[model samples]
Target chain A: MYDGIVQDLIDELGRLPGVGPKSAQRIAFHIIQTESFDVDRLATILQTVRERVRFCIICGNIGEEERCAICRDPRRVPTAICVVEEAKDVVAIERTREYRGLYHVLGGALNPMQGIGPDQLRVAQLMTRLQDPTVEEVIIATDPNVEGEATATYLIRSLLPLGVRVSRLASGLPVGGDLEFADEMTLGRAFEGRRTVER
Target chain B: MYDGIVQDLIDELGRLPGVGPKSAQRIAFHIIQTESFDVDRLATILQTVRERVRFCIICGNIGEEERCAICRDPRRVPTAICVVEEAKDVVAIERTREYRGLYHVLGGALNPMQGIGPDQLRVAQLMTRLQDPTVEEVIIATDPNVEGEATATYLIRSLLPLGVRVSRLASGLPVGGDLEFADEMTLGRAFEGRRTVER
Candidate 1:
């Protein structure tokens, strides 16, 4: 519905994860009309990211080098590895300032419908890392969805024989969230995973 | 929360319209991981759009040349012109295929909160265009929101003494919208502008 290059820019932007047609148009217009928007800088960054960024050879996290920053840092605990669905999940976990261990990015979770399975993920790489015998625990931190749960189950099954402790991130009501708004599955999980308090 | 270039890319993407930090991260990751996404093409288009596209000098609509396609067309009625707030609105009106006239883009609406006034818009250029004896009518098709309404009102006051027909697009119930779900203002407008139907 727009002229040549404007429409082309919108079409490319619309292919991103959450951008719709209207949003694409708005962004494209902002780029075209706003003089201080730094079109060259954004375009340069896009080109640079494509040329520079790559997955860490060890954990599959995004980085420029063979290993990501966390994997390269010797201060982090190598004994405990937090396994997650993607590199984004690693960042989410890192934001909490709780986990001091390294990470393993699975690339994606198991989805039978989409034909994604054990072979599609970095499951073999994870297993190879566990062969060191120094790693004591593997914490599965995939999303609390069907595909994530299936992936966790599959990982648990595969890691059991290696004798390392396997654990999953707890499922329950979110912090500061009202119980009334909690879904049935979450409420049920909260009840099932209930812990006793000291008197 | 991320490394150098990756974080830089995310920060840039986050500055776009409707994209928050999380969405920016997702888009950045999509660019980094998806080999088939064609990052070079998107980046190249961004650069090309900035280098090539410019607004039509006559009507203030975006195009590659001195005047936009609509302004250059000879078949469209020269007597009637649709005055809209932006180039995007011209596309919206054209999609309906209901109007067969030229367009005059005002750049933006009269937004007092944002310090936008008549001088900030293309009001003077519109007046200059209307000076031609051949022009007979002006249709104000700005948005239906507060700023758009204010702009329409301002345009009406300015264009009244021009000795040409001036009209605002009808405000009422949307075509496929339910009357019960209509907002109070819209319902009131519907009643105020009610038209008699012939059986």
Candidate 2:
């Protein structure tokens, strides 16, 4: 800590996720020294994000209004709703330019260790969104981790009786990634999900 | 990119040093999602720092007033001033609990290729500070880089005629760092700076 405001800035920066003390120090100095960096714009955006941005009423995804862009998009298929653990996941899926369905953000996956359960999530909201008769399939696009798997399993069990086709995003070897470097579980999953190539 | 404010926040965060697009997204989300995170306070601090913080009139270190905390503190040896390239360097030296002297921040090292020279730095301010009869010794704690070495050489040439004793920070193997993996230059410096054990 150097002085009053400097130390305070470092402390605040350090509180951000993945920003350790050393990183916080570097960032604080960066903000101070980088003459071209617009600190005012960043602060304003932060304030605006807090004030204007909110969860979509229908799907729990982040939005400026009651409905998110995907929810409001007429081009998206209403018959399919992709369920994800967070709003960021929605962005990741969108980046692929493949999925053209509405999204249902669960807010977070079920993590029993962290005292986060289905009740703690937007699971109720997801269920409510599925009640629409136009929905045909629910794609589980949660992370390939224990908590995400548990959440997907719970949702699958719950959605089976709802008379909807439930599906999940496939986990396999990523493109351009080394096959030998892949973990045992990913390799096993790849083998399990093997499909016949069309001639 | 995310919807509206989310994307805006991510963009703003990405402008920060060392924060890549992914890290920016993560930080932006963290700021929006964290329940206890005081966005208001962080914003206030950034604004306050920008408003209140200023370079010291004398030494060019960051200060709320005309003088920095170290400069204001009478306990520090006024006769011995440590020279560094940036305000961050002052904090780094302060952290060691070794140096209890005033500091002169040069703003940046002499980078001739990049067009930074003696005139661009706080060279005149440093020379003025050294003119004080009470001031005896000047310690150069600039980074051990080409630019820093050039700046040090320039300072030494300039200060020698003034009859003030000038010293430089020692270059050697870092404490607790593996010697086997140490670069040749570092190993050579370590050998050159080898100190005899007191009997």
Candidate 3:
């Protein structure tokens, strides 16, 4: 489709999660045509990210330091650890400003079809973290999908014997969403989790 | 939304064409999480593309050397020169395998709203290329939209005096496209350019 190095650039760019071939070509051309585009800077950052970024030792979250920002922050409540499937989920929770507790990233949810079992996840590290006497509750904030639910179920069974309180994130229709558009499963969940309004 | 360098990487990726903030974050996280992902390779290619690729001196098409592949290829018909709006457009036409002529990249279309006119394009270079005694035809393959039509119109006016056979890529409903969904302008063009059966 394109010359040697140009085609190579497009192929490499297309390897990213969502970027397809057309997008890769468009991006490659943009980098080539836009004189003001900082190609060196982008390249340098990519190299730096690869070199400097690493998973936190305590939690599976990504950061430059040994421990993630949430784990390092003294103000975050250590008693309640919110467990999520990935580091990106931690960022999503952080944006809400609702949860002021620590996080434990599982790296990924369990998917038996992909051969990703409990051992493949950071479950062992999470269990080890729960041994601390001060930590009281574990919040299973994994995604509401099938794999996430299975992972949450496994974690709940494992943590119940340890005498720690376990809770899963509620699933229901999203706020400000049209009820008519809500799928049957979600509508059912919303009905089951209905709470009385306080005046 | 993310930590220092991670956020910076996301911002840089978001600057690319068609990449939004969420997609940038997803790509950044993929790079961070997947150790097998060739970050260094991608970075090196980015640097190489910026350092090596330059527009062809003969026509404005992009290449690693002074002349583009088409311009250097002796097998191509030297008598016909196809004029295109961008280097990408040249690739599109090449894939069709219908044209074997040389190419002259205009870099962009004539858009008065954006302050782009004949001066901003490679019009002079095209005119100079037309002066070759062996060149017999000049095909305008600019896009079908407004700016492309304006550029084709401008080129037609400029090339008519030089006695070169000036022509334009036909406008009409695309092949295999739904005629019912075709716009009025396209339908009009199709009617105006209707060819007679040669039986």
Please, what are the lDDT tens digits per residue for candidate 2 over residues B130-171? Answer: 889888878776666677777878888898788887776656
Window of ten residues with lowest summed lDDT in model 1 chain A: A190-199
DockQ scores for all predicted structures:
0.76, 0.68, 0.75
Ranking by DockQ: 1, 3, 2
Ranking by TM-score: 1, 3, 2
Scored on chain A only, each candidate's TM-score is 0.87, 0.86, 0.87
What is the docking quality class of candidate 1?
Answer: medium
The 10 consecutive residues of candidate 2 chain A with the worst lDDT sum are A190-199
Off by over 4 Å in 2: A173-199, B173-199
Stretches of model 1 off by over 4 angstroms after superposition: A173-199, B173-199
Candidate 1 TM-score, true structure as reference: 0.88
Give fnat of each prediction, in order.
0.86, 0.74, 0.82
lDDT of each residue in A1-199, candidate 1, tens digit only = 7778889999999999889887898899999999999988998999999899989999999998889999999999999898888898777666656678889999998998999989999999999999998898888777666787788788888887778887766666565432323454664455345332211
In order, what is each prediction's RMSD in angstroms?
A: 6.3, 6.2, 6.2
Model 3, range A101-156, lDDT digits (tens) per residue? 78899988899999999999999999999999888878777776678778878998
Query: Candidate 1, residue A6: CA error in Å?
Result: 1.0
Model 3 scores what on Cα lDDT? 0.81
lDDT of 2 by residue, A41-116 (tens): 8788888888988888999888898988888889889998888888887776666566678889888889988999
